[model samples]
Target chain A: MSRLPSVRSLVAALAFGGLGFAIPAVAEEPALEIVGMGSFHVGGRLAEVSGQPPRDIVFTPGAPPARIDPNGLYAVEQMYAQWFKPRTERGRVPILLWHGGGLSGVTYETTPDGREGWVNWFLRRGWTVYNSDAVERGRSGWASPDVWPAPALHLPVGNPFERFRIGQGEGSYSHDPAKRRVLPGNQFPTEAYDQFPRQLSPRWTTTDQPTIAAYIALVDKVCPCVIVFHSQAGQFGFRVAQARPDKVMALVAVEPSSVGDPARVDVLKAVPTLMLYGDFIEQDPRWPTIRRTGIGFAERIRAAGGHADVVDLPAAGIRGNSHMIMMDRNSSEVAQVIQTWLQQKGLWR
Target chain B: MSRLPSVRSLVAALAFGGLGFAIPAVAEEPALEIVGMGSFHVGGRLAEVSGQPPRDIVFTPGAPPARIDPNGLYAVEQMYAQWFKPRTERGRVPILLWHGGGLSGVTYETTPDGREGWVNWFLRRGWTVYNSDAVERGRSGWASPDVWPAPALHLPVGNPFERFRIGQGEGSYSHDPAKRRVLPGNQFPTEAYDQFPRQLSPRWTTTDQPTIAAYIALVDKVCPCVIVFHSQAGQFGFRVAQARPDKVMALVAVEPSSVGDPARVDVLKAVPTLMLYGDFIEQDPRWPTIRRTGIGFAERIRAAGGHADVVDLPAAGIRGNSHMIMMDRNSSEVAQVIQTWLQQKGLWR
Candidate 1:
């Protein structure tokens, strides 16, 4: 897959709409082609104080794992994103996938349940997809307290379960197989609970301003696009759409836990918004309030002559879905549902 | 599949713990077997003035179609239920599946999306299941304005869509397919929108008392059972559990839009309650308030040392779920999740 062409060849290739390798026609090959696969950093500032001495660390571990240059300028907090463009792009706009709290672009790449995720789902449908590791997340540069003002917060073990409602109360953290209590009717792929923990990333409450700024920069780089946000990124999607209504063709909020100002909903008149919800929200103490706020924003958008669609899966005869709608066993089916909506919106062919 | 045995043969068959047909060893066959199948009516009184009501009328349409008696005791509001018992009942308690507003026991039959519904899901899990056509709906019985205090209420088109978050405003019922708009992330099988309208039954706002009485009567007939209620049936399930706490082994409330008095939550200390919700609930104008009330009741239950399990599928990482969780594309998966929970609760072996 990585048969690289020379810089000269690559520049020449970009002339044909960033076309990369022409995938050979084979019966088994998928119809779509990844014409462009590239990455870039957004919203990083030049280091004002450089020339700091690098500290040496243990090189290898028999007793020690490999480590090096522990004191270099390794943290920037600028976000990193990768874009995949299809050779036969049928979409009017590309999709920008933003992950939720304490997660990265990995959220769209593969689900916690090890299912083929939204990224592939979108691509197979002939839409260019950009997956971003937002500021201080995933491939994005990490924040050292020394450089970033505030230290990144570490997510405690069992917090995801507690906050996510996979289990009830402290019983979620119980080590005893007998003591562990999964909430009844949970749509989460509990068999793969072990895989979920590995996906958790450190998050900082104080980084909202910077992260939003970085996300807006990403929007600037790829605007007039569909922005799909999940969970914590819900607010970012709303704010970015507000900031660049013309650039954001559409916004899809998948079980967004929160969003921005409800009163200023008129700003999103040009950008159609779709709010997707999962199962078991009424049971959550906090989600209902946040969901109400988003609904308020949506109502205002409609009042202002904007198109906002709210799809409650359960009410529609689809059920037993969790917050990670993209990761559930029926993730692809859910993706197809979203894709159909997108098609109906005139975003995709 | 239907090999009826005589009463004498059935009595002799009871020697092996009510076992009926032995499951075939073929891998294609499901493990469970329907050992018992029967139907009965609950809560109806004989018409006191029947002698004056022997008038016969045409019951069939078309010029040459057949005709039959049109006047009979068809206005009785007694609830009707059919039970399917497994050969080897693994679950300690039988499950009583109740329908929702403007629907009948058919709600638990085939899903709106044409999938094998929850009736079979629970049965496959080795539980004796009772599917009930509630009073004033379906085969249970229809009440006339003459017999009942008020006429039945018909839910207007677009109300379900608007209240259920299935679409945007009145545009849901638009005749022009192009003009019709469905909520973007709606889990409701919009493809089955044509089918959904067919499932709507004539409902009565004033029949709550009689309906509740009939539901309670049904519970009395089938005591020590797990009652699974959806939407409108939620309140009935709660009241029944309250009236006969000992009879109800557990209660599963699936997106019950309205419930009982939150103040009297203490009375439900013995029976475990599981409240399930689907997506986009916050968007609904009424659901947020109702959900808060249910949450309040759940909190009281916990404080009272009762096992009140609130399963928010969204928070649990499953997403795009709808109020009709049992009818979702992943309905079986969801049923298994509930089955696992039941097992954990010691309701099933």
Candidate 2:
């Protein structure tokens, strides 16, 4: 793949618009060429429920009674995926982006701070992008409470504030900006911190089987492709790769919270993998243990004749990143790093 | 705007691919040019909650206690919008699509049966499309129960089957396809009927204020535009137009369940409106009342020197449509009718 130095310069120019008068306007750059774009749902099964009471309810406040027959066949646990095919291809395979828990494909679409997200960034670099909402999340429908009885877990505002490492530690977050204790050189834009939660969906603990099945089906449909998953999807990425090593060209796990079964590490022998973590992981309450799990998995993969690279952003000299590295201020630079890695691995055409 | 006959032919050729061996390959057509595409969140206020219990919980099954600090200024009620700008423009203004209750912007996207949806349909017709998820739905974050209080309403699988007019009557739907009583000449694809609920979301009763406020904000952001809203968003469409009559060039309400305030009907005097309804409204249990309300509002607008056209599809020679007309079997034909109406009204450039 030919590296476009001009695109990087154009991004730099747009970042510092007025200060750099010598730089050309952003409009002068050739528009990103998109050959095709569409979305589809994958996985899910028809489930039948019986012995439920038939109730008459109003859809609207004062509308006539509409009978809701609970005993019927319901389609449940399907995942949604939207794909954008670039006219100019660079990667040998498409890049499938899977989001973390309590989130959907929106995580890869646009940043909470209203900036271009990784999906667009990678697409601009000449890769077909497939952004998906996991089962029971976003456009992917949820099952009835009877089918999946557990209530969806919610992340309170302060939970991510401290857990994501945007704040220094527990109790570091506050309603007032002045009182909120942000890390000294945090890469996250705290001004738009509140906007982050807008992308979060209610997550369930019992839907992993359906989620994995859906993801496998997606891989079966469009594979020999790379997977770029984040946080909770880390385990999914690894497990999917193990399930179909011939299909998964490479794996990029961004701050993965969990790893796959160590027994299946040998299955990923041919899949080049990158376990990418961000700054403040060493100091965060739970990240240290989570990072170790990822590291342990990486070590296991390497022992099994697989290529696994554990990259701590701070050690790599890219600092101040929180758990949400993809949404960080230097997100594009980080994306470029991944792009370069793919090229080195000979995955980029 | 010039209507490209070849594009329509291309769609037809693809639809009947094997039957028409004489037609050119789909790749022969020029790719759809997208100059820009991005998304953003809008319209939410910081709501502070106090006197809630301080509980410790695990985000994951085995994770450590993440303190849930409930007393704080939490950002809620924000709506999310994603826009696609076609390289070539045909409409004098953009088209803003608003979805109904129990659904998000996904309703305007790909159909449950895996066909291109209205967003792409309009974009292909050269209109810049802006699809939005209303407040407390989809990518739009929801407020804490302490703030909004009321539980969200859910549509059981059978609710839409009969209510949307896919089934013949109240007890027409059954789990088994053979046993089900689908309406004769039903436009909905019953095989994919199960897929429709995938787009349904948990909608709250108490979020109308914030939802309206957010939609108004969206209108304020991209205006002098046409709004095509469906179902529950009908009230929002009319109310927003009333709030900014000059900005809303035209309004389309497809099977809108409710109308705007009767007192503010005069505010829509300058906005040309279309209250479009599908088949079975005359015989449906609740649709007659709902349709009357829409027709009544249109009459009020006309009496106030405004132009409002109420078109019933079956009367207009297009039959077998459900309330979800956008996803019906003849959805493209329905879109064409709307396009023709806009062209005749001088909304198209």
Candidate 3:
């Protein structure tokens, strides 16, 4: 394999003292040399609109009046994916990084604090990366209220702070930075916590059918592939893997909030899977039960003669994590753990 | 200056027969070598929400109850920018590409037909590129309806058909492919018109303050720079340039539907500007008036002693262009025109 020495890799080599594992450093890294980059949308349906009052308005205040005819065939419910192919291929399959609910592909692009994200990390490891914004989020445009029915949900600023384990507990967040409480030894950069909300997107309660169909189409377009999903997208990773077992080579669920259909768990038996849980779950209001359910799902995968490893960061001696593990300060360390697993599964070339 | 001989440049060199000007070719091109790439958010304000009913719901079907707290100091109205820095800098200033209304930075990304968009077009030319999703769009999350009381305006799929000049005239669109009417020589990839609606985003009618503020903040972050804006962002380009003439080196408005503040047009005296309009405007219901207003804005800039050129594409011998010139079949040709103009202005290295 042809490898161009990068400052990041050099720093990683020095920090690891010749351990032979390239650990990423927390720094602005050099641009990558890749074969190409592009984007595409998947899984949209056309629906017609009618019987709405026409409104004549000036699109530009001084421009001529244009009629907004609220009646036509509209395209709705598509997911968007942007892929980057590295110059050298070191992985057996491409890696699809899917973000959780209320977020988009930006979750994997750059950290809230402006640090290198998982997309670049895996790309540097010689894997083609397909980063996606699921249906109705970011580049994946939303449908009208007629189709989605319920209003999209927005995450209150304080919700994720306590729910994601970034703060001590409920009522721990404050508009004032000085009063905001961070969990003891928390890995998140609390100073940049204010920037975190910018990455949060409005998500709809209904849209799973379209979302899953999009994922299946993406898998059909580029696979056998590995899927690295976080939080809300955990269920999608499993469901997509089950739907296209032949295309999905591996699954890495990062603090997955949900799992696959219990009845359909066996279909993922042949797919190597990793379930990672972060710290402070025991103290949070909800994570404990969610983590337990994830464990049960993994056990079933193993019981079906498949391989699945559930790693609790605290138990593994890797502490100070939150539900937003990928955005935590020690994100690179956690990424290394998954890299090691992919290597062990012989998925890394 | 170090120039990497890319397949794109090679193809362009051949296609143009070595005219000494490199025109981009229509093909999937190689990845760029750059010093780095990253993203950041700019211009958000904190607003408190209260007196809202709290709801209990399952975030994931099997997860524990997570309270939906709709009340708090939520961050709102930030714009998102992802930048790519080319390895060999060619331009004296970076170029910021801002999208029009009802669209995100995806406008400058891959076209709806899967062709390379202007983001890569400029990046390949060695200009550091900053592609942005404006406030309340794409990666830039929206505020609650409490903050933005009006429901977002969505474009009915057929609206842009005639409005963008893809169809021959009003009522020229049909859901049936064979029945749809295209202008005599429309340059848009009409076959891919179905994919176009996927790029339309939900836009608020009353977001100019936060939108302009966010844009000004972005200008503060990355300037002296060139700004390339389209359609609805036309007013923003003029407003932001007027607000930061020192930082804004040049402004390129592609078929801008509006102009800057007439009272403050003189502030742009030191800033070079280009107003590009596509064909079929004279026959359109609104574009003729809109185009006249845009030309008037250019005349005002010239009257104020600022350098401004208003180029009607058809008059310039480039016919059959649409409002979405950047995504049209001859997008690269149009991009070359912009590039040539920049060169003449001495902005291009």
Candidate 4:
């Protein structure tokens, strides 16, 4: 029943005090790969023959086929660390945690002294977070994305500006985010003052939504899965749900800023949807409020054939949500709610 | 004395009938270069060389003594299309517009509308914007970040999950964010789920900060400049100022979210600073209210001999102040405040 190696075995296999990790071999975890899909320009051209076949495979949250790469080594703090160890037996469906704007998936979650992050929350919960940097925001590595032979890292670099400069700022954490990160390709000097297009567009957004669709397809393949959207990412999740209702087993929306009228979605299925919010909503302090819109939104989602309910929790006592929720002070409680909800449905925690 | 050609000339040069230009470059735009400095990995061994010598000589902002690609032709969107001819020629201080999270800086003025961005706002008032994407968020193209390249686009190719792909049938916008646009290096599927190391990091956030610093140094050697911060990119502007203060005349922080207490900076010298916030703020509702810490943050800067002020606008009526300040109802007022501040001080514009 246990396809995953013992935790002791993995710890024993890892190099603790060095800048790199050396693992003997874990028959439990296989390497992750994407067939012949190499460069975008060439990948587009090679699609006919390779069918985008992966040379090897690994495991990630919300990913399909449950491929695991036990040998994958990530460099953190100059020391190579194994960031993830996927369970080959598919212990449990992964949790897709979508963080809010200006934050990485690690977000507001940190150690008690405010130094640690949420890498462990899902790890202990028997759920894979598929956790990485918020694209260009975290320490998921991958600094130079345009280098030909291939980019070095493929994870978040953490907030490049103020955040990355801390001690042991290797990977994306060393780069600055603001001046350095903005527009994907617009990395030139402003003959006129302009902000972005630094370069590197993910396949999910912009004129193309392959990312959004691919995610839903993933959810469909990994049914009985739950997705947690934090802040601005809530809007993105809503957009996905609107596009494909059947793909989602349940949705845990935390302080979502945008929830399109679910009524507009005809295919919207009746899933166990939990829309949670903080009491400290932001707005004009007068005219329209978060509750008015949020409640209406919840009602709409519920009416649209989903078992939806808006749960307002006590404040985490932070300065602002900043569009982040999962990592808030009450994250434990939030986790419990999610677990309970999923368990209630016997969807497997 | 004109370093750049005019719109009419650009149109004639391109000879293309699209008033609104896309990626295709026009000869009129000083040979638009879409080159970018992505993650160090993507930049490969090329990044270190991009910041050649004397610290400021090779990699200054506007124009460097030595070009990273001296004789190379790079593709660019020709950022700041709305207001360059008037400002640069006038020798006005350029306004550096750092972007908010999840958005490229090009849309600084309005929320992806066809209007000028915040950078353009100052540009219209005789300032320049050195906007660059963080890394992989916008159209900025990137190469495979893997040690070995692979094709993942079979999923995102002809991405059909875009926001506008409504009623497109099953799997329309179903391309997975995790599997689709991801570069080749992502062997750890755990982090790849939900399509991560986000295009959010984009290139310029770090690799280009120095690139931009190089540009700014050149621009400053010729003309003084000011820094502007909006949302997530706030910390970035501060970092740039820290890297080079003499070049930056002042700073205008609009509804900034990062750059906590200002006492932590020694890299930047004291300068006139203004921190603006929208009355309509975004809140988690469940989190304790986080005041605009940048105000006191500015005070700390002032205490350290730097000048800083906190100015709160009347009901900004802006939705997602964390996201939309430059495009809010009070955007014109925001522009006016900046213009007035610039004009009153006789700082170039």
After superposition on all C-alphas, the RMSD of every candidate to the true structure, in Å, is 28.7, 7.1, 6.1, 27.6
Among these predictions, the greatest lDDT belongs to: 3
- What candidate 2 gets wrong by more than 4 Å, as runs, is A1-30, A46-56, A70-73, B1-31, B49-56, B60-65, B70-73
- lDDT per residue, candidate 1, B1-349, as tens digits? 1333332343244333332323223355244444344455567542222233332221111112112222322325566676666667788989999988766676776666666677766776678899877775654545433456553444433445555556663335553446667766666776765445434555666677777888888888777898889877767888778778889888888877666656676788888787776667676555576677667767888797777767666655455666667766656655654665565467877
For model 3, the superposed segments whose C-alpha errors exceed 4 Å read A1-31, B1-31
lDDT of 3 by residue, B48-149 (tens): 889999888777778887778788777898889998877778888999999898889988888878898998888887899999999988888898788888
Write candidate 3's Cα lDDT for A193-296 as tens digits.
98888888988867777888989988998888999999888788899898999899899999888999888878988898888888888887688889988999
State the iRMSD of every prediction, in order shown. 30.9, 2.9, 1.7, 23.0
CAPRI tier of model 3: medium
State the DockQ of every prediction.
0.01, 0.35, 0.59, 0.03
Alpha-carbon runs more than 4 Å astray in model 4: A1-349, B1-83, B87-91, B135-144, B147-223, B260-269, B282-291, B315-322
Task: Please report, in order, the local distance difference test score of every candidate based on alpha carbons.
Answer: 0.64, 0.78, 0.83, 0.38
Compared with the true structure, what per-residue lDDT tens digits does model 4 show for residues B1-349?
1333333443343333222222223233221111110111111111121221221121111111221121111212121111122313332565556555444443353232223335444444435455443333332333332311333221222221121111122233223344333222211132222221122222222233433343344334433666666654566567657656767777887755556325555444455776776432332221112234555567678667655655554332222232245654345556665554554345652
lDDT value, residue A226 of candidate 4 = 60
Shift of residue B30 alpha carbon in model 2, Å: 8.3
Instruction: Kindly list the per-residue Cα lDDT of model 4 for residues A260-317, writing each as its tens digit.
Output: 4455744545666777654333332311243465567667765666556555543322
TM-score to native of every candidate shown: 0.44, 0.88, 0.92, 0.33
Error of model 3, residue B152, in angstroms: 1.1
Scored by DockQ, the top model is 3
Better-scoring candidate (DockQ), 2 or 3: 3
Q: Order the numbered candidates by TM-score, best leading.
A: 3, 2, 1, 4
Ordered by DockQ, highest first, the candidates read 3, 2, 4, 1
lDDT: worst 10-residue window of model 1 chain B: B58-67
